[model samples]
Target: MTTFRKIAALAVAAVMTISMGACGNTGSSAADTQDLVVARSLETTDMLPQTGFSNGDIWAIQQVYQTLTRNKTDGSGVEPGLATSWKQSKDGLSWTFNLRRGVKFHNGRTMTAKDVKFSLDFARTARDDKPWQFLFTAIRNVEIVDDYTVRLDLNEPWAPLPSDLSMSASSIMPADFGGKTETEFRNNPVGTGPYKLGEWKKGDYIKFVRNPDYWETGKPKLNSVTFKYVSDANTRSQMVQSGQAQIDEFPTAVSVSSLKKTRNVHVESFPSTSLIWVNLNNRRKPLNDVHVRRAMAYAIDKEAIVRAIYYGQAEKANSMLSKNLMGYSKDVKDLEYDMAKAKEELAKSSAPKHFSLTVQVQSGDPEKSMLAQILQESWKELGIDVQLQTLDSTTVYSNRTAGDFDVAMFEMTNDISDPDEWMQYMFSSSANVNSGYRNEKVDALIKRAAADSNQANRLKDYAEVQQIIADEAPEIPLVYKPGLFAVRDQVKDFTVTTLGEYKLADTTIARE
Candidate 1:
């Protein structure tokens, strides 16, 4: 059987299996229990705060851990998290955060300034493989001012320091936690959040139980939360439709339409800072040529893809920064889809007339597969042969990090409310996810934006950076896809934030 046929068969099998399970559980009492099961696409065995790179792992960490500050779901402001309040020095080089008193970790240890110092220091010095290490690079030193106060001194005036502290990777851990190695910490994670780690069964589900001594009283309405690893989109949707799972993340467009017809399911869509794009390996042959990269960018029909594949659920993106972000420029325009322009640019390149290239997509993602097929057809019109390669999420991420692909489909959420979080991580020459693309001018602009204390100066620097990136076309900006989730009707007060976080502390189940 061909690739398309094989994918179709797997999807059909998944739907049938879920349907059978739903039928068998019609009379079961699982729904009446206080536990809520959420189905997501990826499985992660490692739970270390600094090592989480995927959406699933980060989402899980948000529930089990607490950061110093929390970005508002709407992306308009920041709220207090583990820190009750904070102040900055006159020079903007030092920050002092006041810890919440009586906060207890999962292991029954009181969280103090010592734990805050340890967490920030660990984040700044973590291994290079961790993508979040750059977020803490500005910190020069972390000092425990007292039992409830900690100070961070930076090498320069980093304007987004507080926002950076809001990330899940900066979650506070026990200062004397007995974790000999990274693997040990992964196996037994501890935090001072509303929930505590309960059990983790690889390939199945990870469970978290409510913390009775949680700092916030009367929160974490649900007694327990279980995150089930369901890689198949069809199966994940079926699980929710059959009432087997209370929530599902990243549901397919088809599933969203079908679930709307059901009485007990609610499909919610929120504008997100997530950017899905086609990453071009700038160091690879043919792709290294600027003309070839521009040709590929002109060939993509982003509007059509957003319409047909996402069912008009997303907006066409023009740059790495989304419109909702702080530094997004309205002047940057998307390259129009024109086959004639694509051919013209290709003719000017030093690439062979006929060459085969591979585009990698995550396995079990129907939307990405459709996108790859669309690109394949478009590139064929320009006399380029394109191959679609489906790999698991882990392998796909690894290849992209190792610069082992000609082209790949990837997505990332803005780490914080600042443009520096998106631009620096995705386009900086020294960034791990740069995809072999580097420009000295772009790097300098990013640095200027991060260090500038003036708001207008920072915005001007970011705008220039976006213009340069648009001209070079390092990646084909696809769409600003909205974060969609399917929730059972009985699940009350549940919401998925624009930052791609699930607010479950106040979520409750309404019993019929």
Candidate 2:
């Protein structure tokens, strides 16, 4: 069997064992009642903060580790996390953070400024090709000012530095935990978060127990949390419906509707910064033609996808940036879904008709599959033979990075509150090797916005950038789906942020 298949088999077996145990149990202990059981769509392969690239990895890391700052539950602002207070230099080149005293790691080690320095340095110099590595490139040096204070000297003024520091990739670890390999770190992670690693059964479930000495007193009300990996959407929904699981992440749209009506099941949806779209390979033929790319944009019925597939749980995306974000432009309108306009645009291209193209999508996501079918049907009407190919996430990402596919359906969420986080990596000529499309003007605007500390100027630059991208159509913006979480009605205070990060420390399980 393939490695993934084997892992899935083992996961199913482990879940069966747990389900049987739960079924056989009598209501005797408070520990059993207080534990929050959640169903996740994927298995977490790594625990190292900087190395994680998937939602599963982030979900695991956020619970075990702590960043200097974190976005508020509403994602409206930032709040103190490990660092109680911080200050930035007038020029914005230097930032100093005052660490929280008496903070203890999972291993009972005291967290200090030195640990913060070590973690930042490690993330900055990581050899792996982590997506967040570029965010740390501006850091000139990390100085341990004292036991409770550390300062970062930046190469240039970066307005989003504080928000960037709040990313999961910037999670602080113990000073002595630096030299361990990725496997070693994943096996035993040490962090200052409210939950500590309890037990990990690979491809099955990861159990986490509350940290008694958590920095925040009287917090983390739940005694334990068990994240069960169940990739199938229907199975995950069934687990929650049968009371086998208390929470389920990324529940299918169909499941969501039914779960909302089910008694004792509470469904919560947050406006996510997540953008779902088709990343066209601009280096390939037809796609490379701006007219053809525009044609594809005009052909897509984004509102229809949002309504039919997402069940009105999502909003049609007009530009690369989501409306919830800072730099999103209401001024730049989406290309209307007009078949006549699409045909006209295509006629202007070198290869006007009889062009065949393969669109790639990840296999498991029902929403993406539906989108692929919709696109196939729409493009087919335009005399284009569109082939839908489904592959695993790893292969799809690899293919995207290598520019091996004609068009790939992908979703990306902004880790920070700034426009630079999304724009630079996705659009900048020097950075976007994935799309392999470069426009000098777009690159210049991104750079200008990145450096300009003035909010108004940065907004103006980003608006222009969005206008250009909308016109050029490197990516066909489809929809922004809300981050959906279904939890038991008894599970209180559990919230998912716009960035899709969960805050579980304040959650509590009410006794029946």
Candidate 3:
């Protein structure tokens, strides 16, 4: 067992007929070497590391980009990536990093302090409207101290800065964008990671070949990787079973037991800081009313969603934050599943009866659609006509950010293991997530927690924040869930960081 498994307050380790093997090349790659095929639930929305919004895009970015600091392989802490070492000031307002020399981007250009400064500065001020802007918002400036050294000047003592820097959003890109136009660079980005883009067909598949000049030696043991767009979870499962794809990510949680029964298939279920929820457009309509929001929350049966969707894999969520997160208060309870209470609350609201509204789901995501249907059926009982709108993941994310939908479904994952990762984006008035779920008290509390160095003080503030959110009902958090992935037995040394980072550098495929 890894250290994180033992120490993580919220992680459960469940494994059957699976063990992580040491990564080693099984054979030399000829043209005949089989590429590892992976099937996922959605087509990648964007290839650029910092801007990609979909799970498909994130999966691809993990393969092609490197951040300055990465989550430790065993879990829950930061480790070096592009930077060999870093030193933080006692005041936490400034930090210096010594970058690894000789590291080359896929374009064969060596990574330098200039690129680091540009990437950090760009991410900090790029687009205030983007959800990830919070990652770098505290950085006052980035200074290129020397050829392989850079320093970050902060506006405040940001404790999450190290973890934030490890995210794909913080990945360093070529300062010159490889001398390509922004549009061209976005379409074909280069990084100092183990894989380089081989081919990308929009709405179809993405191919990544091993980077010949990767800084890490004896890495990316496989010749290449193919991530095929298979939106349906069942088909993704079938693809893995039939050897069409060696791995399937986000395989329906309920199908895991059955999938594990198939020959040579292994199911990996591990703890994660994921909160599945229905995000109400608090800026719109009756949803703006706390009564209506709480009404919808009470109507939905969280237990049924767990049983039907997660099988035996999940626990009903208590509050917006997952149980694993710090300051997850046991006292802040979820609204019980009470249809009658739902009616009372609905009746109390201005849009009492025969009111119609829509809830949007990601078109091909089984979980989102099923969860929406569940909401659709129950919200109807309140005399609320619910319209089900199914859109692609890209549009779903765009609509949410633009506040263009009545309601939306999303399985929110923390980019880092910090409570503020979700707290700021989901509840803070300053966040551009478009939730419109604002409380000046919450805004004040979050502001205090972000700057406070003492965990004790932060925890007290966050607890109050959670209770306030529970009462307000901005989002109906359904479950505190686990991460699920189906892999071929031949794929060896398969492991993800506690933060759910798919670090493939040490992974290899075994011989038949």
Per-residue lDDT over 216-269 for candidate 3, one digit per residue giving the tens place of the 0 to 100 score? 888878788888888766677777776777788877665677677777778987
**Which candidate, 2 or 3, would have the higher lDDT against the true structure?**
2
- Candidate order, lDDT descending: 1, 2, 3
Taking all chains together, each candidate's TM-score versus the true structure is 0.93, 0.89, 0.90
Instruction: Name the runs in model 3 displaced over 4 angstroms.
Output: 1-34
In terms of TM-score, the best-performing candidate is 1
Among all windows of 10 consecutive residues in model 1, the one with the lowest summed lDDT is 21-30
Better of 2 and 3 by TM-score: 3
Report the lDDT tens digits of candidate 1 across residue range 330-404: 898667788788889899998738778999989878778877888888888788999999998878877876788
Ranking by TM-score: 1, 3, 2
Would you list the C-alpha lDDT of every candidate in the order shown?
Answer: 0.81, 0.80, 0.78
Better structure of 1 and 2 per TM-score:
1
| Model 2 agreement with the true structure over 206-301: per-residue lDDT tens digits | 999999989888988889988888866667766776677888888766556577766667788878888888899999887899999888889888
